[model samples]
Target: MKRICILLILLFIAFNNSFGQQVLKKGFLVACGDDKLFIIDPNKSNNNHTEIIWKWVVSEAKSLPAEYIPLLKSLDECKPVMGNKKILVNSSSGATILVDIASKDVEFYAKTPMSHSVDLLPKNRIVVANSTHPKGNSIELYDLNKNEKVLFTDSLYSGHGVVWNPKDNLLYVLGYQLLKTYSLINWDTENPSLKLESSWRISDKSGHDLFRIDADNFLISTHNSVFLFNTSIKSFTDFTLLKGKKDVKSVNYYPKNNSLIYTIAEESWWTENIYMVNPNKTIKLPNLKLYKVRKAI
Candidate 1:
């Protein structure tokens, strides 16, 4: 009994120390840009110019599989999946891939012309959007319970951003000039389908990304500016974080850590041509232009 008690005490101390020594309080931010992906730690790196903790280049990805070779072109959206153990990436060249963080094992799920964004849903369903290609200009839902299979389809023009919000049981999709919300009822059933609930005109040109500020609020990125949409009021208030440039690509909000990371591009695709927006100011890095940014938390 005394030996067992001593072992328990030691385990408790080790657990406590691990938690106390945790440094990446805001977790890591995965930024995907032109054929490259970077992991940035907010708490550890310099606030002025945060360094990338890790990076994956196109050369390494091209060696994986012949099907995944297309993923080497214009990697737009990279999202942490399965508790940041893996990453789901969407490229402009009709490739949707999920990669293991440790082994770098790649899984090619679906292909569409100009695939832009992918969001993980309940029951291992992956929802994807394609920006170009006439046949691919629609929202495609794939079920990964067994193999990847098309479960549903909804038509949209310039489909770019998609997010499944459990707070209101709604799936929000963004097109070029319209924002649509669908009721995610019957989602757990075999024949589950989303019903269109609401639609709004967000931008006349390009709508880029969506960040959930809360249960009833969201920050939407566009080619012109960012807008805060209030679900209760069904109205939009433009918050132009960038004054002169219309290149704000992505925004990620970490509520637990009270941190926000956004990317803006200038004339080039280099990180020096991009800026990372913090709460008070923006930090410029000499790296690749970031297309999508996601907090690992």
Candidate 2:
């Protein structure tokens, strides 16, 4: 009994320490730019460019699978996510890898076939939006519970977004072309049916990402703007974001801190910087050269 108690205490301490290493507190902002990914703590009082905590160079310049080259070059399409003291990065390599922020190490990596998009699901499951030549587009669920995973859905449009609705335990999938729903656990689609609702158009053509905000609204971005959508009304109120830009790649609204981070463009593909907006709805962050990390989380 005494030995068991001692072991339990040690385990608790280790877990706590691991978590402490990840919390950003007040000093840092995680930033990933072209080729390089790092964490910057901007408030040093003495210096404006605070110390870089971690950095990794991600590029197709290195020897990468031919399949992934398309995904990497198409930088605007990659999306990233934070999970388990690590970040999950997925791109054309059709590969998903977990990076340990503390050690700057890749925890584990597995290859899938060109993941079009991935949704972070409960219990570390990655709900992937994918399509094979003949299968077409569908929702594929990767159970992190197991190492290499299996397909959750067999049919879906090739260009759609898979989203998890938290209010109720249901999966909300909106394709660039269609919309559907299923149970997050298993590929249970009884509520929505087999075929996605072709009733609504998710995007015009050059599709963008959808910000899963409050239960009532979802913030979506096209090439040049961000808009808030009220599902009940099936209408959207456009947020006057950085205008007169050639393109707007992606946008994320951080409501907990009352800020929104958006990427703008001077050209068709490259970026200017990430802008933070406030009450007057003005862009705040100092202008800097930043680019998308290129790997979708």
Candidate 3:
């Protein structure tokens, strides 16, 4: 028993990457819930948890009625967008916001009818999936240039998240009720065309989200597992986190340090700390909640 316990302890440290002391630095994770955004710096101390660096007050603006300003759902979308220091937030009533990290700039904001999930396309436009019942599977593409644009509402019953394939004008989608991918070749096509290339049949799957990591790779998260896939390879031998089985809720990837940012469900909002994944490490605490911990690509 002593030997077994000792081995487990060593493995725990190894998984957390304590041996090298190469803890994640500089970057932070942002999460949103009940209209508040949170920032976490893991590895400091359990006593010192993710703090609310800053927040955006969405009260009623006399002109636009802050009351009309949407409220964000999960902390996942609240975390910074991939390759950006800006955070992506969606209002329960259907507003999309991009919050800048350093400058604290609300760089952009758009309104939609989406319920829980939102995505920013390569064209600088935003897309959001609904939260209500199925049958109205629609993706609202919001154009900042004008308070309007086209919406892809065909065959999309519901969506968990949307991702832009930079290499090609394509969107990867996941949702509570379905998981599918659409090639937006029609965005610029004469008739505005979309091709349903590939998809996974999913039902009763909540908190499902799809994130684009690179041209050939992406990440998908569920209540209990997170997967990494290589589009080029079309096969994924992914990582399984020890976080509570509740749909990872959301996830983010940082391009600056090549790290995956993620959060686990906690009792108190503050208890939900964010961790940076160290892909090189192969061992860890059973069901450990970590971010940026991925395989060598």
Candidate 4:
């Protein structure tokens, strides 16, 4: 009887451990205008309750120079990269940095005019989308090993977002009223550049955010509404959930759980709240000036 009881207890503990492993760990990484990035649990976070699991302040970054602080003001993008081992972040204030998650070290940094989004590329390369500043309105490429030096530039009017699609091995860029794809030309060589392969007109003008939904689709937000662009079909369709919701600043969708988290520009270009659906939670960070929310991977 004693041996049977011990066996039952061990089985129970094993079962609980297996169940815990099956549960998904859900969290979000938010970029704020106050030059900070926060990873928070929406289920446990609210205006009165704070459940920030991790935070990074741009001005306090040890690897950044003192003078560069002013240029990284409005932290707009914080994207998980390198299999979530690192984060790629940039600001509308014209600075981008790749940070090591565990060490909190800035691995790569660049200064671009009105940089709104960024993505990693093959061969230690990075691409930035520059918006409507004097030196903006272009897609700029840089080497991670060489800081502050632009390797290449291509004109993309009012560029707002960039994402690398590994399935097709093309770089997708979002600009005013257009979504374009580029093939890497001479990437293995020192004189690397992007060759325009194709372009598609967005359903609306003022394209804002472009994020991968899966291998075949991308989540795009414009001034008027959000859409899903099918890479295979080369078409755009309204994202039914936020179909007509205007001024959506950023959006991320998890198909596994059918969950989504997004930010809307409520007060001009920023909001004080981050919203989630499919579970229906609102995480309010009063006075934080939240700009974008990407799923913490």
The numbered model that scores best in lDDT is 4
Every candidate's lDDT: 0.71, 0.50, 0.52, 0.84
Which model, 1 or 2, shows the larger TM-score? 1
Which stretches of candidate 4 lie above 4 Å from their native place?
A: 1-28, 46-48
Best prediction by TM-score: 4
Candidate 2 on 1-297: residue-level lDDT in tens?
Answer: 999999999999898677546644332445543434555443331223335555554541333444443443221233344543555554433555445555555543445454445566766677665534344455666655454556455566553355666775556565544445565433343222223332455444333455567776676555545566666677657665533333455566656766665666554444545454542222222333343322121
Cα-based lDDT at residue 276, candidate 4 = 80
TM-score of each: 0.80, 0.65, 0.64, 0.88
For model 4, what is the error of residue 201's alpha carbon versus the real structure, in angstroms, after optimal superposition?
Answer: 1.3
Count: clashes, candidate 3:
22
Q: Candidate 3, 219: how far from true, in Å?
A: 2.0
Off by over 4 Å in 1: 1-25, 47-50, 58-65, 146-148, 240-245, 254-259, 268-274, 277-289
How well is each residue in 65-171 modelled by candidate 1, as lDDT tens digits?
56657655788888887767667888886677776565455654566568888888887778888886877778888775533467788887888888878888788
Predictions: Cα RMSD each: 5.6, 6.9, 14.1, 7.4
Instruction: Give the Cα error of residue 211 in candidate 1, in Å.
Output: 1.4
Which runs in model 3 stand beyond 4 Å of their true positions? 1-26, 39-46, 49-52, 60-64, 70-76, 79-86, 99-114, 133-136, 148-150, 186-193, 202-204, 236-238, 241-246, 253-260, 266-271, 275-297
